[model samples]
Target chain A: MIRRPGDAQFTAFVQDAWRPLYRSAYLLLGEHGAAEDLAQAALTKTYAAWGRVREPDAAYGYARTVLLNEARSLFRRTSWRRELPSDDLPEQTHEPDPSDRPAVLDALRLLPPRQRAVIVLRFYEDLDVERTADTLGCSPGTVKSQTSAALSKLRRLLGDAVLPEGALHD
Target chain B: MTERLSALLHDEALDVPVPAAPAEAIIAGGRRTRVRRRLGAGAVSAAAAAAVAAVCLMPSDGSGLRLAPDPAAASPLDPAGWAVSAGSTLYLGNGATAQLPDKVKSIYYTSAGTVVRTGTVAYTDAPDSAYALVGDDGRVHSLGLALGDRAPSTDPRLPYLAYAQRRGNTGHDAWDVVLRDVRSGDVAVSVPVDGSFTWGGWNAPPVALDGDHVYVGLDDATLDVDWRTGAVSTASHLPAARFPESTSGRVALENRSGQPVRVAEVSTGASVAELSPGGGPGEGPAAVSISPDGRFALLVPWRTCDDDNACVYDQPASEVLQLDGGRSATVDLGDQVGWTPDGRLIRVTGQGVDLCSPVTAVCDPTGIRLGEGPVKVGGNSYES
Candidate 1:
């Protein structure tokens, strides 16, 4: 193997960025095995281009972009296609239980790939419309529309007490 | 409610179980990638090595198979010479050549190197079609991509290969315009195409890379995608449905019948020059090719053949039209023609390749010949 001085730096980056990248991947993919595969693929691609990553501080951003791209690729699979959103909501009312995190996760899984991605990038990653659109490789208008659709689905899945109608405005 | 949902989402992400980071695996994969690019250092995969062996063992008389002695240091637009492929051998202009195991289908030029699309057959797109990059050092490195039949585009200044891939496995109309960096073999950007596909008879949409923007040909409109910023906009000035060839600031618009008719400004639909005469059927030329700088256009006229059963349309003649001045000069077209990076004209015949000056229409022989087989020139050779 060709050894470079950047190997140690990349190893350090892997240790630091792995969990956050994995968490983002998990949020986007909504499963452990797919999330792990997506995260590993992103990190592997990041390692391949490590020599071109000029700033060490920007490594996380690069890996995150790659992770999102990998998730987009995963969304093209047959199983992911089966998760496309339909007009009819689930029969059961997803009342917010004491542990509301599970309810939120369930609602997230019901969304289409692009809509789910919009939700994760906006609320979880704290990205605005333009930045989220850039990350998702779409326009700000698309980000806004997908965000609106995903929030509507989430509101219907979870009761109004957990997510009020006013939440749609923001 | 928004804050609560955000907090819950964060908590939900954090609540998931995590596994140990596979540092060794990632590092090893990176090392493999690095090794694959070091073709000059004699590091190649076993499959690529065997393919090289197969190419070397092909029948040749040791005539025009010379390898470029030094790595290319010239600008891509001002290439040292022309490159062409016959059977399995690539004849790099000026006595340098490289042989491949598969037949060369099409060739694309980039600042980093010359990329060739290879398949088992010459003119047919198959499932086994692969791409390889012939570096300036005269070494071929496999890109390891088998993108099925979708047309990919490259610019003379950029090192990225751009193409369109479907966004879903269920055969949806959505697509993502993907750009892969040639040097690193990593996907630099994947911009999702916001529009639906109405373009019939294509596996996916065709892409044309000019400077920073790649033009995707759709049925309703041509999408001007910025590879750097991932911005998608409509190139409303160009032709709406048919594919257009984009260069510096000019686009060659295809007519309703998918034949080249005129060159126009990409910003506005103003005509730069008429590629063909405006009246009557069968008046259009057989093929029209624009220069890399978008300053000149080559129109190869069709000729009548005595034999009906076995006939070809492209004659051994051409009219070189200067788009800026509206003046044209007739030149003798060889078997095939393409443009150099510096906007010079190149013609290839069974005898050899010739460098032609577009202004004077004078052809100068470069003394490159590959015995006997079908020859495909680079630049615009594969254009129809």
Candidate 2:
């Protein structure tokens, strides 16, 4: 294949953005194969829009936004296999261990796609309400409501161990 | 609480083995996109560049239209013969499918042909969107236009595609609502709308195209823009509406309280018909789509998923409301996106296409397989 002038720089960007993008995709989509596909699709799209990306340093942010958008689209597709939420919540009467990965991931899979995205963006990505809303293409009020709803649901499911009292106050 | 949740999330994300970055594949995809963009470098490319430049150098006089040949008279096909795009293929009413150069994001019907928006993926909001006009003969003509986030609006009776483009920075109160003739690939009209408009969730102002008028959604009010003469006025009839969905000269209005209470005439604030009030709190029905003649409205009731299991059923008992007599029929709206010009409800799914009637609430299966993937009907809001 013939190489373009910006191929090397874009290759470097893909290498740098791959891991974080994959992790974020994994958090949004609980499956490994789907997460890998989402991350790669996002990076490929970022490359397509590379000409518009004025600042090279901002490439990662652009890729992240693209990944979130792709995740949103995937959630909307009817063909996508949705993880059905069970009526039962795992009993958690004690302070939950932070390293308890299954409980958190399962709880996440239980939340609606939007609420899950809000949790991932707010807690994992550490984005504020406004930035999260901007990235998710929603209103701040929507972000806040979804965040509150998600936290309340998570608290009920995981109990005070993982999300303690006054957690919803945040 | 934030810290604990954050820690738990980090712990969950940690140790997930990431595969090697496919840099070569990504670069190759990007290269293919660039080449596809330059498909017709002579006329179409020049026209696209001119349109971009005209937008960049928006005239202060509110007259940015670059003159081109008069568009051919609109000759829309039978409303029964509609088209839909699944993946990269466009399934026409005649049972012939045309493969698009890229993944079809959304399709819009014009008298000229089915206007197709193709992108890297089927996401309506994806970047680097390219527009093409697909004829009945299955010939594809690239419009060479890449409208970033602005949704394209079209009236089946008209040959132009309209959208609102904000001028300058966020603080700027000025916007140029452009109408591009799909046939000639020229800016037929561009008028400036001055206001500190807030376009709620949309990257740019949302617009709805009627015969000669374009209703532009702004923060405080909807502007009635006469594209032919560049006359701008407030469509007080619509009030402060966003995502103004319209066809057959009627605009569907959503209640500020989140319910769709009525459908109104665009010209006059006259009530076309009063929509049935949705269910009680949290169960309100959403006005999803309107029939082409504005005589029928599709209302899908909101379903509450279990808080613990967040599982939403695939299909809901959607209803089609006759605006004339208040008669309603139950139909599945999960896959129904738009209406045929003759007023039949168009439902597209991975299985096939189904055309339903609003009056009888009965769907006639087309048995036309769209193959596999997401399907976007031509008259949907994503393509307007």
Candidate 3:
């Protein structure tokens, strides 16, 4: 368990929130080192506002929001670049058989930060367009447009065999 | 797609190892980030910055921006050293020597001096600092307040600095814009404001010291705060735009529209000085502010992913618009230091501080260079 700094409840909170937030950060950033950094940074930001966070359960969401915003800022700045999508497949790994599962990660890396974020929130987080819009600070129109564009890119990268074109509209 | 994605994510989440929770670290980092954000005046305004953000992120080769390691050698800090950040080591300008505190979080270069924020092991951490202003004369005066490191902008001609401060972390989160007389080392006046914009490419500090009066922008409104008296009044009739980074609140710049068109006078919506920006739909311009001399407008056009059909994410470009309404010039900037006192556009690239004069559109061949390799961070100016 992560030892809480000043409060007793925070240790349990961090224990519960760690994996999920790390997972989201991993998906959003598409790399291990950056993902860990992003998750930890988000957690730190949430910790700074622990008093203001209000509800104990909402800490994860707040941390996730900070992570996304920080990721957005990092990407928005020129120092870091998000990986673009590729038509080429990855080099063979030592593992046995491979499905297109690995391609999803690669394909996700290809999407721009904002579009990738929209997909993660809308699909992975199971958020509605309105909620996604609120998270991204864009209108529902932008959310819809980004989702459509991101889906279209994913479809192209993954192909109709794995991701049927008609099915992505949902 | 959603079901498969969910399942795939579940497996992926399980695949990654859960490291021991670093709760103490998180708390420390959080506090530092809060200080940086609050000090930046940009942390609280993510939603606001997003609301007014343009979709332009130019394509870059990522050739120069060094987020990695550069060699350590004993080299005199030059004028270029004033603007670069390599790890925790700040390249003190003009071959000067001063010990930067342990766990420095944010570094703000003001006209009066350079302010260093010290703190711990957070993603970014600092010493418990109100903030320390190291004057050009080599005196470091501790303000003992949580003023954003780079939030204060000083006038080159005068000894006045304008900045903003938020109340305590919780409860009533009231924000105040303040003016400090650098000569007297006193806060001349403090005006209450509704909101503050964060630090990034798109926003500038709203509080500016122009002559005797200070101009500031609140969310959707602009106000002129008197320096002599704490009297604050609305610069009524200015367009509903953010002047987060303008020297004169009398005029504001924003990019909700197509290109980054300048709102001539905030009080009157007569827009002028529209530059021919090289961008598509969401690739409009933002992060716009005027040079200290008022001769040029600096804009960093945002590159949006909305237009990426291939999901091709790339990095690149900075633009300068002539305030006289002439053509704009594009510079290949990797990292930006604020404008020099003489108004030379200084950019730290793979090379060093290339001081480019806007009039000639020519950069000095020889400029200050941070030691070779990747510069960890720092080169952000408070003027921004």
Off by over 4 Å in 1: A1-170, B1-76, B122-125, B257-259, B303-314, B381-384
Residue B370, candidate 1: alpha-carbon lDDT: 66
The full ranking of all candidates by lDDT, starting with the best, is: 2, 1, 3
lDDT of each: 0.65, 0.65, 0.50
Per-model RMSD to reference: 23.9, 19.5, 21.2
Q: If the candidates were sorted by their DockQ against the true structure, best first, what order would they fall in?
A: 2, 1, 3
**lDDT over C-alpha atoms for residue B171 of model 3:** 26
Docking quality category of candidate 3 according to DockQ thresholds: incorrect
lDDT of 2 at B325: 84
Query: By how many angstroms RMSD does model 3 differ from the true structure?
Result: 21.2
Clashes of each: 3, 3, 30
- For candidate 1, give the lDDT of residue B97: 77
lDDT of 2 at B248: 72
Task: Tell me candidate 2's TM-score on chain B.
Answer: 0.74
DockQ for every prediction shown? 0.17, 0.18, 0.12
